[model samples]
Target: MSSFQNLKKSRDARRGKPRPNTSSTSGTSGPGVTNAGDGTYGMDDELASKAREVLSTALGIPLGQDEPGLEFLDDPEVEITNVSSYDSHGRKQNVSPGIDNLRSKDQVTGKGKGKVKQPQVSNEHVRKRGKDEVSHELYKSELEGSGIEVHTLPGKGRGLITKRLIKAGTIILKTPPSISALQNQHFQRVCHGCYLTMKERNIASCKNEKERYEKKMRGELKIKLNRCSGCKVLHYCSRECQLSDWPTHKHECIALQRFRKMYYKTYPTKKQDDDDLSWTQASPEPVRALARIIWKRRVEREKNGGKDGIWWKQIASLESHVSKSTQQEVMRLAQQAQHLQHYLSASIPLKGSDVDVGEDQLLPVNMEDFGFEDVQEVMNFCSSFHVNSFTLSSPSLTPIGVSNSPLMALSNHSCDPNAIVVFPNGAKYMELIAIKDIQSDEEILTSYIDLSCPYDIRQRDLKERYRFQCDCKLCEKSKNQGVDWVDPRWCVRHEGCKGGDGKGKMPVKGSKGVVSVKCDKCQEDFKVNAEEVLSVVQKGVDVLDSDEHRQLDYKTAQKALSTLIPNLQKHLPNHSYPLLSLLRLSSVSHTPPQSPKDLQIASKHIKQAYEACYEVYHQNHATPTLILCEYAKLLSLQDSEQTKMVDLSRNIAMKNTIIRNLLEAIEMLTKAVKQSEITFGKGFVVGKELEGILEGCKEEMERLKRS
Candidate 1:
C-alpha cells in the first residue's frame, strides 16, 4: 500500500474502526455495522461473548469488568532480607582504611549530647533481640557492590562509597517509605493507601458527580474510592488498600473522632467546617508522622518489655542535628510541641460521663504516659524530618507528598550529582538509581534541588537548609571562573554574533539588577536590563503555571506559544521553556496538527528542546526521554509521499530527507525506550508505554523499507 494509505489504515486500526470497502458499502448500513445477516449483524451476542471470553483469558481481566486500577505493591525485583539475618551473618560494613568503622567507639561516646533523649535500648541491644520477637524484615539493596562501604568523613559525618566500579543508571537502593504523609493540599484529593489522585485520571475537574459516574460507567475512569466506614474521613481506591492501611489509621481515626467532639464543644453551635479546621489538618503532617513514630516505639516497648525494635533503633539513630539547631529553632519547635500537645490533650473525654466505647473501638493514649513531655525530643524528630524528608513526587518530580526513607536518606548530596532518585511504583516507594558512572571508592550523590539553578542560589540553599558548603566539581569550576558564582539571567547576545560589530569581544554574563553590558569579546553593546528580561520570562512562566493552559485549544495554545517564545528568547536564549512549549503544542496526539507544516515546525522544536533539556538535565532523566519520543512521533507523521511529490529533483531530495528522518526517528525511539526503562523500572507505566511506541517505530521502519 502507498504511504498515505498505510497511515490511514494504521489510524483506522488504532481507533478500532475498519476501512470502508467501497464495494461492500454501496449503501448506508450504519456506522461500522455491515448488514451481513440478520438485523443484529453488529450485535452478534454469541460472537461478542466469545471475543470477550478470549480477551478475559488473555488479559486476565474479568469478562464484564474495566481495567484494573493502580496498585502499590512490593517491587518483585528487590530481594527482601531479614535485618536480623543480615547482621548475624557478620556481613556488615567492609571497613577500609579511609572508611569509618561501623562500630566506631566515637559513635557511643557522641550519643550523650543530643536534645532528643537517646533510646534506653541502644542499636546493639535491639540487634540482640531474640529472633522470635522479630518479624520478617526487608533491607534496601545498597549493598550490591561488595566494595560498597559506609564511612564517616573526618569532618562531614557519614557518606557512602562503592569499593568497586559502578556505572550510571545502576540501582543503589529500592526501598519503601519509613513514614509517609500527603502534603496538606493533596490530603483530600489523594488516597492514603495507594496515593492515587483524581488528577492522574484527569477527573479532578469533573463538572459534577454525574459526569464522574458517566465516565466511570463508560470504562474511562476507575478511581472509585471506598470511604473508611469507621472514621468516615479517609478514602481508599479499593477494599484491599483500606485493609492494608487499617493498622496505622485505626489509631489516627480514633484520635480524629475525639478531636472532632472537642472541636464542636469549643465552637459550641458556631458554624464551623473544614475551612475552620484547615489549620488542624495542615499542621499535622509532621505531627501525624511523629504520632506514628511514638506509636511504633510504644508498641515495640510493650512487645519487648520496654525495649525498642530494630526499625525504631534505625529512626532514633538517624542524625537529629539537635546540636546544630539554633535557640530560635528550638523555641519554635517547643511552641509546635505545645500546639500538638494541646490538640492531643483535647482528645480525652471530659470528666464524668458513661462514654462506653467497647473493645472494637480504637482509643487515644495520654501523651504524658508515652513520655511526650520531653518536648526537646519532639523538636529533634522535627529537625530530622526537616533535614531528611524526601518529597514524594510524580515521575516528572512535581512534589505531591513528603516521605522519609531510611536507606534512601543515607545517600548524600552533590551539586553535580551522579545519581537520580525516582518513585517508580508509586509515591510510597523510592528508587535511587545512578545517572552517571563512578569508579570504585567514589561517593554516590543526588541533587536536593534543581541543579540547573545558578551556583550562588544553590550554595545559599544548601547552606541555609543542609548547613554545608558544597565543593562539588561544578561549584569549584564556577568559583574559579569568577567571584559572582553565576549570573541568574540568560545572556542577551545573539548565538552567531562574533562580538563587537565585527570586533572580537563577546558578552560575558548578565546579572540581575544590571541594566546593560558591552561584549567582552566583540565590544558590541546591548540595551537590555536583566530585571526586564526576567520579568518577560516570568510572565510566560505564569501562563504555563496557570490552570487554563491545560485546557487551551491547540490553535490558541500555538498562538500563545508564538507570543511566549520571543519574550523567552529575549532572556533565556537556550531556555528549555520555549522549546518545551512548542513541543507540547505540536505533539499532542489527541489534537492533530493543523497541517504537515505544523508537524515540521514541531520536529524542529523537538530537536531544539531535546538539545536544551540535555544540556540542563541528566541524559536518563524523564524530560529528555519525553522530548525524544515526541520528536520520533512528529517524524512518523511525515511518512507520506505527498511531501515528495512537490517537483522531480526536489521530490528526490525530500525522499532522501524523509528516509533520514525515519532512520533518526528509529535511533531516538530506541535510545528513549532504553533510558525510560532505566529511569523508570521496565514494568512502570511510562516504561511500558515507551516500549509500545518503540515497537510502533520499528514497524514503521519496516513499512518504509517496503515502500
Candidate 2:
C-alpha cells in the first residue's frame, strides 16, 4: 500500500467505533490530561452515569455534578471494619476507642492501642471478564519475564498490567486455546440433553462474527437440537446439552425477544439466518445470573436503573415490556430477536458440534432433525468440551471484555489493572495480556467496562455492566486530569493518538512518567496551556512542511518528543508511549543523494535511524521484528555495491546479518509462544497458532537455504 494510503488506513482504524457521532464524545478524554472545560469529567452518559448513582447510594454519598477534585472516599463494595490503625511508620496510632473500634499492639512497647474504623473503599471493583477466562489463562504463558508479576499486584483488582517494559505493537498476547475449527471440537465435553458430544464447529476465529461463521461454513456438520416452542433459537443435539445450557440460554432467548423492535428500527442490513441465533432461548436463569455476574455485590443496580441515560434506562426487554403484534411488528420482532440473538450470542460462546462446524453442510437443523436421537444426549455429544465460547490456544492473552456467560461474567474491572486477557484463536481463542508494567503488590484487575471511555465513562460502565464503581487511577484522575481526558480526541496515524490538533491529533501522550510539552518553533515549553498545545504542534507541523524547514522537522520533532515523552514515562512503559514512537519515527532515513555531501548526510541519518530501530527491538519485539526483516532488506540495498564502508559500518556481511536478524526475530516470537504454552497450560490455542507460524518460518528458512 502507498505510504499515504497506509497512513490514512491507520488513522481511520483509530477513529472508528460502534457509535460515530462526534457529539457523543464526552469532554475530558483523548490526549493530554488537562482540566475539562465542561467542569464535570465527561463521564455520566449511557453507562457510567447510572453506575455512579449506584456507587453514591451504596457509599451513602450523593453524587453531585462535576467537581475539580473529585474523590470517592467510601467504597460500599469493600466490607468496612474496625481495626488498630497504623501511622506513617506502620506503628499503631492511638485514638479514642468505642464499642465498634478496633485496636492493635504498639510497636515501641507492644502495648495495645485504640481502634480505628475502616474507611470506605472506592466503588471501582467491577470489571468485565475476558472473552474467555480459560483463554486469558492460556495467554498468561506469553508473559514470563518479570518487571512486575501481574498476578501478584495489590488492591488494583485482577487485570493485566506490564511485567516489564513493553513496546507498542508487540502482540502483547495472542488468543489462547489456539483451537482451530477441527481442533476446537475435538476436546468438547459431552452434553446433558443427550449423550451426544457438544463440540465447537464454528471456527471463523477472526475478530468478527461473520468471519467465524465463514470458517464454520467450510467444514460444518449438523448436530440436531431439541427446539423451544416460544423461541426457535436454540437447538440441542442432545437433551442433556439442551438441559445443561438451559440455565444460561433461556435468559438470552427471552432477552432476544425484547430487542426485536429495536433491530428493525436500527439495523441497516438484515438476514434470514439470523433466526438460527435464537438458540439462546433455552436459558433464562442467566438473567439473575447475569445480575450477579455483572458486578460486585456492593454495586447496586436498582437505583441506577431508575436514573439517567435514556438508552440504558429505556432498556428494551421482553419480560418487562409488551410489544404491539402487527405482521410488520411480528417480522420486526423476529428480525430484532434474531439480531439480539446474534449480538448476545457473539458476546457468549456457543459450540455447535464436537467436530468443526462448516456452514456449507449445515441444513436447517431442529428438534425433528435428530430423528430417533435424544436431544439431551445428542447435545452432550455435540456441544460439551468443544468450547461453547472459546477457541483455545497456547499462551492466549485475552482482551478484557463483557460477555453473557454467567461464570466468566463475574470478572470485574480496574484501570490500574493487574491481569491481562487475550483471544489466541483470533476471536475464538480466549486469552489476556499484562500490557502495563505491574508491581509486586496489586490486585489482578480487569475492566468489564470499555477502557476507551474517559475515567468517568469507564467508572460508570463498571457500575452498569459489572455493577461497581471504578475509583482506579484512570478514573480518579478524571476531575483534575483535564479536558483532553473527557474525549481523548485521538491521533490519526496507525492506532495513533488522535491528538488535540484539529486534524493532526494523534493518540494522547499518557502521563506514564510526565508529559513535557515542548514548542516546535522555540525550543522551550511547547504548550501555551493545556488546549494550546494543539496550536503549538500545528505551528511546528506547518514549519516542517515549508521547504527550508522540512529538513529540520525530524530534528525538531525528535528533540521535543524526547522532552515531552519522559514526562509520560512515570505512568506507563509501553511502545504506545509517544516518546517511543517519536524515537522510532526519528529513525526512518531516506536514500542518499548522488552528491558526496548529500551521501554523507544520508549515511549519518540512516545509520542513526537503523541503530535506534534496532535498539527498540532489542532481544524480543513483535512489530519491530516484522519491520526489521524489511528494514534489513533496505540496509542490504545500500551496501549492494561493494564498498569498504560496508565492513566499517556493519561487522559481518550486510546480507548475512540481515538474514540472521530476520530469522532471529521470527525465532524470538516463536519462543515467546513456546514460553506461553508452559504458563497458560499446554494444549492451548495460542501455542497451536504458533505452530503454524513456526512452520511458515521453517519453510521460509528452507527457501533461504535454497537461495
Q: Candidate 2, which segments miss by more than 4 Å at Cα?
A: 1-411, 421-442, 452-469, 477-523, 527-665, 671-681
Residue 307 deviation, candidate 2, in Å?
A: 34
Lowest lDDT 10-residue stretch of candidate 1: 23-32
**RMSD, model 2, all Cα superposed?**
22.3
- The local distance difference test score of model 2 is 0.27
Q: Which one wins on lDDT?
A: 1
Looking at model 1, residue 374 earns an lDDT score of 64
Candidate 1, residue 454: how far the Cα is off, in Å: 0.5
Cα lDDT, all candidates: 0.44, 0.27
lDDT of 2 by residue, 668-701 (tens): 5465455544323344433443444455555645
> 411-481, model 1: which lDDT tens digit per residue?
55554566655555455566766667766666656555334344564455344444566666776775575
Model 2 poorest 10 in a row by lDDT:
105-114
Name the top TM-score candidate: 1
**Candidate 1 lDDT (Cα, whole model)?**
0.44
